[model samples]
Target: MAIRGALRELSVQLSLLNRQVGARLELKDVDLDCLDLINAHGPLTPSALARRTGLHPATMTGILDRLERGGWISRDRDPSDRRAVRISTRRDRNAELLGLFAGMNTSLEHICAGYEDADLELVADFLGRAAEAGRIAAESLTAE
Candidate 1:
């Protein structure tokens, strides 16, 4: 019960953080999410991005168009498949965007440092599982 409550609180905090980041960047939360995906495992194809984001193909196209126009990301032709295009953040601007969240990252690291190595490993494993659960939930939402 405590873990469920904590998870709910964490989800709210994360949503708020994303919204704040979106407002500060003058971008929508969904766009920020797409940027995050690209930042983590970028150069992904448009279809792959749509699948991961659970966005409709048409909607993803629009978001990609907006990001490209904002100079936050670019669309490139896939070398292996001329008909396919890849989505990726602008390497030059990625640092600038990431800087916005550096403080949060530092704080997380500091908190993690308070734990013993074994405890930290357990935390990591737990968080990984929790994140996987989130993906599963997102999949269910998309399926509907």
Candidate 2:
């Protein structure tokens, strides 16, 4: 029960942090989410992105359009499938995006410094599994 409460708090805090960062960049939360997805696993086709995000195809189109208009992403022909288009974050904007989160990253590093190697590994492993569980839950909910 304690762990569940802590995890919920952490999730809410992280979402709020992302929302603040998104506001600074003149981006909506969903746009930031899609941008993060593209940055993490980019060069994905539009349909693939739509699936991963659980966004309707039409809504995904609007999000892609906004990102492209903001110079945050680019749409290009897929090399393997000339008929389809791929979406990717613009390389030039990487530095700018990183700069926005530099403070948070630095703070996290400081917090991590207090943990021993073994403890950090345990925490990392737990977090990885937790993230996977959350992803599966989201997928199930979307499917339903």
Candidate 3:
């Protein structure tokens, strides 16, 4: 219950931050999330993206279209498989997008600097487990 409460607070804060970033970039929440995915672990195929995001094909299409139209991302054919299309962010604006969260990232880094190495490792493990749990929950919801 305690961890759940903490995660709930974190989610609220992240959503608020996401909303602010989205408004500043003239993007919807899902669009921003797509960008985050691309920036984090993307250059992913459309099908992979849809599965990762748990978005329907049609809805993912709209988000991709909007992001592409806004010049935030680009699509390309996978070199190994020409038939497969992969999505990536526009390199020119990559720095600008990352800049949005630079302050928060820096602050988090500064906070981490105070933690002992073992404590930091524990925190990282906890976060990893929590994220996996989130993924599992999302998958279960989608499966239903």
Q: Candidate 1: which stretches are off by over 4 Å?
A: none
Candidate whose TM-score is highest: 2
Where is model 3 more than 4 Å wrong at Cα? none
**On residues 1-144, what C-alpha lDDT tens digit does candidate 1 reach at each position?**
998899899989988988988888888999999999998988899889999999999999899888899899988889998998988888898677778888889999999889999999998899999999999999999999
Winner by TM-score between candidate 3 and candidate 2: 2
| Clash pairs for candidate 2 | none
Alpha carbon deviation, residue 136, candidate 1 (Å): 1.5
lDDT string for model 3 (27-64, tens) is 99999999889878879988899999999999999999
Best-fitting candidate, scored by lDDT: 2
Models ranked on lDDT = 2, 3, 1
Off by over 4 Å in 2: none
When summed lDDT is taken over every stretch of 10 residues in candidate 1, the lowest stretch is: 93-102
